[model samples]
Target: MSRIPPIKITPIKLIIPAMFALTLFPVFYKIEAQDLKLPQCQDEEIVNTVVDFFISESVWSAYGESKIKEMINSSIHTANLTLKNSCVPMRRQSGKLYQVDMTIQAFDPDLASYRNQLLRVTEPTIIKEITQKPNHYYALVVDDLPDDILGKTDVYLDPQFLILSDQAEKYTLEHELGHLANAWHDDTSWNSSLSKYLEEYTPDAHKNELHAYARGYNCAGRRTIMSQSSVYYLQLPIYSSPDIFFGDETCGDHEHADNARQLREYARRLKDKMKNNV
Candidate 1:
């Protein structure tokens, strides 16, 4: 009988490169709900809403899964308060609930680079995706966001994704969600005009440097969640009402009331669209 060559067994060391490639190249990794250990809430309706959690390998390596989950849970609780109190009721009247589908990804190379990619390359795709569907939103949580912006929502270009910094405060997520729901900046009309004029007139390279001055001079001084000023007033008590202008009655402004009306109208429009799709 002819000698048969022993079959070669691949060394484990040789296989590692392929494994590493597989791990590095995948677009995203799904995180199971059990892994999150999500904080329980009394309201089953809010709890029932699906949340799809995702984290980049880089983020997981840096923050660890536990820390990431903790941060996300905290944000979710804040968001739930806003949604349950404010958004859901309006949505329910239309025979539909406000459903949120959020995807959080970590930036590679650097957070700033990712921000540039979002603004330049991916924004169009994101806008198309969100407009084609209803009740879907995306958020990117990163170690660093633009120095001037703690959180921002571009409703026209990328309504799905809000860029949030890691150091974002308790109400920041809720504030960005307000934008996703069609709420404009607390002082959008006046502040935008003034800011634009300053940008045109000022020769300084740093345009946002004068933003605070512009806001102070022209803003209506609202205390709503959408206000740029609200971040400074975190001492105010939280309320369990559907109004975006719920806290600090003394600081209320007509803009807050207008925003509430806008929110309701936005919800009604979403409901009508959902009905039409069906």
Candidate 2:
């Protein structure tokens, strides 16, 4: 009590700080909601493509398959898209399934490390022999993977195979297939030109739109299934006009056309290489 001088409480300081926080809270909350919003299906073709993918799968469990079908039906109803019966052949026939031994030192820590080491140590000749056909796809579904990795594809391997974690999304299979098709990431140096074009030429009609078409790479104007940075579908529509296409001319003024071209070229080159070896 001897030193109980005036406890000078700065009322103005307390009031100012409280007012500032109240003023900013609503703005911060609104921004966070917008950022956290999940992407919604917008294009009819994209919705149908997703449906077709689920229908084409032959390896999913009965329950898993039913869930995918249910999702497709719900998306269709929500988007008001006409459903069709068409289905393309599954690009990969079921091959020998390998359960990655997560406990092994060869696969310890993370699947990415294991994948890299596996590719490095394993011979292409051995893989080709084991696979029988050099162009047959293989499947490797692991029970778990490092928390950050959903799925991965080794395009360097002939008839590329995908390694997926159990928790991966239904669409992850299609995403890895994009890698198998030799489609580079939308932001990778391989697609830099297209990325630039997307940034500069986003149309007024599409301005402020949040369609799947506008969430790829840093471009934020074109979406592709190959994009590691966007919410996209497996639909690949070719366009004849810039009015419809979202990327640069290297993409043939069409969505997914460049990826298609790359796959064809890769197939041709691989075929030639194999023939020469024989």
Candidate 3:
């Protein structure tokens, strides 16, 4: 070949950029799942579970290779650690299973991953269309969710915050899932009649700042997976029997069962809810 200029590295590098100007090959770098960080949760093993009862291979596949890898990377980078002033747990009576209709569209590659996850997770449950009859077994998801929620429950995301913000994403995902899983606020119904001191100190409007500590402490002890101290793995796992099935296992052990501090925190929430009229 006529003097093939010694492999021109600089020119070669420019060639791709130059080519992109004329050609349309949407190129993107591959993101590795290892790059992300997840904190060592209270119960590490339980937190890592992706059991058949929960998200299985089929479900994982739907997350799309790139997106799944990205979510993992983000987690790795941030190291899913606990945030102070963060915790949410609600209580709802046990009932028959219900289906949730979570129809969401992806506006970006990352957003798409979360939407896909929602579609996949609810697969085992019946997806019924909107009709006149009331549906105890299904829910209607109307919008796209944020990133941390990628493998978790999907919910309407607020525009004020970035979907990828670890704190926001995790909190939002857990809160919505609380509703999806039918968990109610530990507030339950407060006994308005209870001494102003009791209501004021509890997680109630009647409660004043003095009891705020007490309110939160009691809420911590209810022992539901939905407790404020839970990590993704500790949240509700899929119950295999059927959509409507609820048994002994349906109830989840406290994610922080070993952590006496968190357990006491939960107790406050529980007490407030059990308060008559509370």
Candidate 4:
């Protein structure tokens, strides 16, 4: 098995390679109430999440079971830490500390053939087949993802499935999870503005030089983890708070995506469902 490059300490800009292949198209389905019960956190300030990950044959061959397990644990840890500090309800808004308690399980199946089907066809045919259980959120860890698409969330179809590339950055998994929690991208509507800012403020000589997207600091930089991976070099693992504008004090008072609020609201809905046995 050919080895993939180790994850960088600072994630690089996302670029899609034609040779690499993975397909996840938009589709919708009625979500069935999961048979697998989420742990109750109704009176408490926590979201009990269970992540079931399917390891592709390529990943299994490259990293083996032990290393794959380590990667999953590390990803979950990063998610937990990010939510703890960045979530407004958890950290700043309320005195109570709201958080997500996440656990992961690894599954090994004939995913090589399944992936081949995806490349050959458009329909997500075999996802339900290999899922060993119901209710727990599911993910497929493939060797590579195409189209600059590091991850894809199945929020509309089942709201329980995600497709992730093993080659993506460390926080890619968390980014997808944020989507599951109803978080939106922080870079929305800033594409043209960012491009213009870079062209105007960035010196022509230094324009080619790579830089992070910080807004107030140097008229360029990122405050939220939901920003595109291309602008992620200097960003901390934090979400946009709903109570404040995305650009903060220095930048314009444009409305941010408010990922923190979305996550908290999603958690609240989940807790209520659990409490009501819905």
Candidate 5:
């Protein structure tokens, strides 16, 4: 098994490589264009956001409401910081920032009163009933998720609703939010191009491809939060970006992926749509 590099940081020039390779991996990233009833992205210079999280009775019982709120808030803070570091134009040129405040409340009044258990749910109606706006997000924190799932997002929704398992890792919210921002996984092509690359180049590269995916390495082999989750975890709150480099490794345009750029585009598109609506 090839040794996984230890987490390290060495400053390098910020230069985001072009994503021409994205066209080759449309299966992993493209969504068909169609009319969507979900909330649209706003055309705003600044994003002042509030995310509401509903705590299930069972989860609240296991970990008090305060603890749950703290964890979620911390995750959001990390996400904001990652955006600040990875996407410079949001703060420097545009004077825009991604700041999200949070509210934690009881999941359901009836469920809270009787300590009723809420099952794992993916039904659109249930989420729609609770999701009030397309500009903001609503997350339902439940007691459990499948062994393989830490959290899941309703991608079809405009402002997505996230179903987070109580046992999810600290940065799981960040990873899910990346999905909401249209950021594809850094390791999304493991079965396709990545496997082929490994076969041609480093056939003995990694013993576990899933772990490799989860590492979400940029060209320099630094971990990015948006990669698929594996036993190897996100050591730093970083996203792959064309504008920032966390280390010394250099990569060609074809080898790069830029989640940070996608986030910037998401905000821009939302701002444009909001302007048209106005």
Candidate 6:
């Protein structure tokens, strides 16, 4: 992602052996080309199989199960965070489930509302399998991935998260769930608007990116969940450590977290509106 100047600090050089240990041989962080897809699975039995894939992929390891539940909860169960003017009522397509497609789709207002309820009103729903498609935004688990690469979304899958196993769990799901959050990415002209931040930093340098993200958006460096404060405190790019943060030199401080307060405010507004609607 770093296309601008070289990093000022000594770059974190990884020895070849260390890189291999982290599975960096096939770096998934390569600049992505076009979106890609998996074999489509829309049939009921096929979808069930996909669900099984998710359970198998997620349950064995503590990290897998915990991450999956957290993702599902935050994605649909949490309160809304969009502006009031944009809020809408949740509708239920009872017994209807959108099959996983390889393609990405903008959030349906009704679906967004219903998903909120699914997260808040109803118990968390778990799919043993998933139906996949191209040109769609979806998530499912598979045996094909390595443990470090346990989680995958198209935004997180075909490209970035598949190889960057260390951060894959959150980034993969956050990238996909960001879509559900009314967050924007990909071809909505974010490249020109946001790419500069990624461009200005060093490869894997994370500080300034966190400061620049507005609501309803997600990306590599500083994003709402995956890119930001993870359960493990990936330090990522914005904050120096779990407890310490750079004061005002947000854009420069690799550990700065300028917008967190504003972000919380926005999230509260959205949550209240959604609750009222429900």
Number of the predicted model whose TM-score against the real structure is largest = 5
lDDT per residue (tens digit) for residues 194-248 in model 3: 3442433334432232221111111212222223332112222111111111232
Tens-place lDDT per residue, model 6, 1-278, is 32222112111221110000121111223222122111221222110001111122223243543454444443232222111111222210111122111111224322233222222322233321112211122233333344444333322112111112223432343333332322332123434645664565324533332333332212233222323222222222211112222232122212232223233333454445445644
User: Candidate 2: minimum summed lDDT over ten consecutive residues — where?
Assistant: 16-25
lDDT of 2 by residue, 243-264 (tens): 2233332222234233433433
Tell me the lDDT of candidate 2.
0.34
lDDT for 106 (candidate 5): 38
The residue pairs found clashing in candidate 2 are: none
Give the per-residue Cα lDDT of candidate 5 at 234.
Answer: 24
Give the worst 10-residue stretch by lDDT in candidate 5. 16-25
Off by over 4 Å in 3: 1-64, 72-80, 83-101, 104-211, 214-278
Please say which candidate is ahead in TM-score: 1 or 5.
5
Q: Model 3, 249: alpha-carbon shift in Å?
A: 42
Question: What TM-score does model 3 achieve against the real structure?
Answer: 0.22
Candidate 3 overall lDDT versus native: 0.25
Q: Superposing every Cα of model 4 onto the true structure, what RMSD results? A: 16.5
lDDT score for residue 276 of model 5: 68
- Which structure is stronger by lDDT: 2 or 4? 4
- What value of lDDT does candidate 6 attain over all alpha carbons? 0.26
**Model 1 worst lDDT window (10 residues):** 15-24
**Model 5 global lDDT (CA atoms, 0 to 1):** 0.45
What ranking emerges by TM-score with the best candidate at the front?
5, 4, 1, 2, 6, 3
Q: How accurate is candidate 1 locally (lDDT)?
A: 0.40
Q: Could you give candidate 1's per-residue lDDT for residues 208-257 as a string of tens digits?
A: 32332111111223233455543343321121122333222332334333
